[model samples]
Target: MFGAHTWRCGQRYDETMTLTLAPDVQHHAANAAGRDFVIGDLHGCVDALRYLLHKVGFDAAHDRLFSVGDLVDRGDQCEEALALLDKPWFYAVLGNHEDSLCAVAEGRLARHRWYAIGGGWAQGLSDHALATYAKRLRELPLVRVVGEGETRFNVLHAEFFGDDADLDAGRFDAEVRERMMWGRELAFNAARLPHYALSPTYCGHTPVRELRQIGSQTFIDTGAFIPEGRLTMVEALTSRQWSISVQAARAMGAAEMTLP
Candidate 1:
């Protein structure tokens, strides 16, 4: 339960605080239809996204694409990246970067803090564009769940710290919610693995040298913002993973600009 504080994303929480989680997949296409795929942190690299989508034969009319959030920042195409939110085939779970942006828009966080965290690209937006993006960011859920039977998958921005029994119960509160969006201890600390009842959780936020798997969780941020990094994607049902190198992406005209 949230303490006495103002709320922004529907649920009640302190405006000065942060949190995160979600489960429900009734909207995805059936197995007979196109596949469901998840992509890593996309920090404004729409070109890289386009290349990876092509490589995977992504059919926007059939296949579904889910982003692990951080879709805007540290790259040049933040405006272009927002196009995914309006696409019928695309879905996304909120990441900490998005949270920061939201906080800034809500006047809960300083513009400097957002700028400090690779959000300078937002300054280029028109008034309408900024409002549009802020509204969309506010509307994004903290989590997205898909699959059934024995292959259920939970997509969140960061780590899930709730008890396994609470996974499907939809009982995430403000504190746990913040952890899901910003927590790194569970994603990076190999020795502190907690047994999440939900198997095969896919998340990003804490960038890794590669897609890392600890227990039932998988971290796929892959540092796409770095020149040496690449955009990573995975077929949820088959566990077939693919990556598009930053250099390759640049060669394909995906690297017009970058952030440090």
Candidate 2:
């Protein structure tokens, strides 16, 4: 059960909860020459991502795309989606699905556990391939801070249950990282206090029908792998959005294949 703990409004921490320390954060300077975009969970929908990027006129040469993670699983093009990590302009924090991949690859978790949660794509993969994927995913930071000053914002796969100082200093432990990858209390509980004071934070683990914001924390997963869901992307500085429906993207792809 991920994030089984209950969280109440204004509550910062539960001292009784225990988790190890795993600190990793990545910082990027603002894209002064071009725009910066933060996208929702990929969930292996590389084609939809491509369509959305094309619609947005994303410039790979100058623009940057930051992901909320979950770059694998569910959809058919998991490998293609994961390869985006190699792109110089693409950056992502580690999502819970990626965390599970690491756990399974390192033998910390059972294969069945992973399979139960949309990991069927890796069933045929060799151990070496799995290890390679895990190694790359493990390098992703738990949180990514983009830009500076008022334009600055934070990107994490899930919830962050701390203040700006705690986030800035990277004081969260493994439990915190777990929550960052799997927690849903903030997204589920509308009354819960916002976690950060300085920079707005974007997260994706908990899927919603549309992009939502509670205080400074924004949720944008949008259920890209589901039948009726869509992959969403938002401009980091302006909150402008672009979305591509999964069904529509697939239909378009199929239609294109039949043509010249």
lDDT of each: 0.72, 0.79
- Residue pairs with colliding backbones in model 2 are 20-174
What tens digits encode model 2's per-residue C-alpha lDDT throughout 80-163?
Answer: 888888998898888878877877887777888788888999999998999888767766878889877787899988888776
lDDT of 1 at 65: 84
TM-score of each: 0.84, 0.88
The residue-by-residue lDDT of candidate 1 on 1-260, one tens digit each, is 11222234422223564543123222332445778889999998777887787777777777888888889889877777777788877888777777666667666777776788798998765556665567677667776767665656778887886644466665666677777777777865768665656757788988888888877778988877788888899988566998876668768765553211
Question: Could you tell me which residue pairs clash in candidate 1?
Answer: 19-177, 19-178, 20-177, 20-178
Per-model C-alpha RMSD:
5.8, 7.0
